[model samples]
Target: MATGTVEHVKFRNRDMYWDIAADLHFPPGFDESKTYPAIVVAHPIGSCKEQTSGNVYAPALAEAGNVVIAFDASFQGASGGEPRFLEDPAQRVQDFSRVVDYLVTLPYVDADRIGVLGICGGGGYTLAAAKTEKRFKVVASVTGANFGRLQREMAGQNGGVIQALSTIGQQRTAEARGEQSAVNGFLPETAEAAKQTGDIDIIEAFEYYRTDRGQAEHGCVLFEAAHGTAVLGWDAFYLAEELLDQPLLIVIGDKDKQGAFGAYRDGHEIYERAASADKTLLEIDGASHYDLYDRPNGAGEALKTIVPFFNDKL
Candidate 1:
């Protein structure tokens, strides 16, 4: 059993409603005098912290005897930002750094031992954050995707990117004219509809977000279409080989084949590109991409590797 308390907390440039809404998990015992390592868990893009990081990853890391924080990014979930679902890769990276900054002020935290764990797009953002943020001593990602690149690849699939970009351009034009940005859903409203789209990623994502399996009533798939262009300029591995000298670990599942993910282990290129000789690439057998997110068995196996990696490196 985990021995810690969880609390809903928020802090930012200083406001409650617009702050980074988060959950703080403390280690197994109460000790105000002792300093402890801290970890930050970033949720997938288009996902709220409550689903993945706040509930699953953060608790696991906290179970391993460290403080953990899981937070919603700007313009999503409980957090507040204008033009909701504005997935600015650069801003998301900044969110990670700011979280670290907040942690630095905590008297009980050992700032030097701080670490970060990001899931999916959050994983990419985490990599971007670690690029220049020296405060994160170590970094790890689960089922990490370079969302910017992923967006481009998805948009470009079937030669739709050009059209998508045109639409994005129009939205930008509307915004410049002080018109409300166009809002649209990125996922189907139901699992069946998503499956009918013949897009495997959409099908799986819908299962997680639109159904009872992983759905959060307050969750959203509607985002500003204009933001899609922002992803075109981002890469998860940005400066990774040169600046990511700190230890790194990437965990992913291996069952996908012929689907959008294919059978390739996640973050393979990242591992190859990272300059850190100490980096590790772990792939859980018999698990698909979504499995790594919350499958009880897969999550257990992932922790076997994750808990040890952070304990040793951090």
Candidate 2:
């Protein structure tokens, strides 16, 4: 049987204590024979360790002769935080770095050969973290979204400025009156209500993230009031040109409709621009955006490329 442990651990930042929802997995054959490489897995936005596919990927990699630590982001999952679901890109990057800090302290981990896997929004955070965190010897991002671009579009789309303002204003009003403003969940319980909004991917996202398949009640979207605090002048794609002199791998679904029609072009262009000579990109045909998470070939295709990349790099 595989060995695992869950604990409430705190990492220091300046002087404040940052609590983490941390899980350490030890494969059946795990032994203290020698130091083994370890990888940190980050879940998607609005997702916890149990909500997203991290639960599958983390242990899979750990079983492949690498120790894996899958943890909930600071404000989400079972982690401690106030005004739940608040997402900060800078802080999220720090979370990955902090996880590395935790891993290095273990006698079983090889601190020199560390790697990280970030899925979806977590992928973007992985890239962002790698930009400065040299501890990550290898970085792999799956179906990553550029957070800054997402925020900019949300603030500038058709009537976006007004819509964002109105939404945030309404949420703040409720909060000021000592009310817990309702936030967005994965689904609305019915297909008709799911289609009311133009978020094309929500239909499928709701099917998985809201149903028993991938559902986790803790993974709720924040209200607009929390948007300002979470997004605050943040952008994930600031420096796509920097070279880390390490291996890099990126995976995206060729059929991801959430990024507009045939949006795989953006991911391809990123792979082309990466300065790492050891960099590789895989575009899976006939796969949807959400398919990369829990779909049949999703985790398989991802591990097929990711494990080897980490093996070669770390």
lDDT of 1 by residue, 110-153 (tens): 99999999987788788888889989999998888887777776
Give the per-residue lDDT digits (tens) of candidate 2, residues 18-64: 57786776665777667899888888877878754456777677767
For all candidates, what are the clash counts?
0, 2
Most TM-score-accurate candidate: 1
Q: Which ten residues in a row have the lowest lDDT in candidate 2?
A: 257-266
**lDDT for model 1, on a 0 to 1 scale?**
0.80
Best lDDT goes to which candidate? 1
Candidate 2 global lDDT: 0.71
How far out, in Å, is residue 106 in model 1?
0.5
Candidate RMSDs in order = 2.5, 3.2
Clash pairs for candidate 1:
none
How much is the lDDT of residue 212 in candidate 2? 83
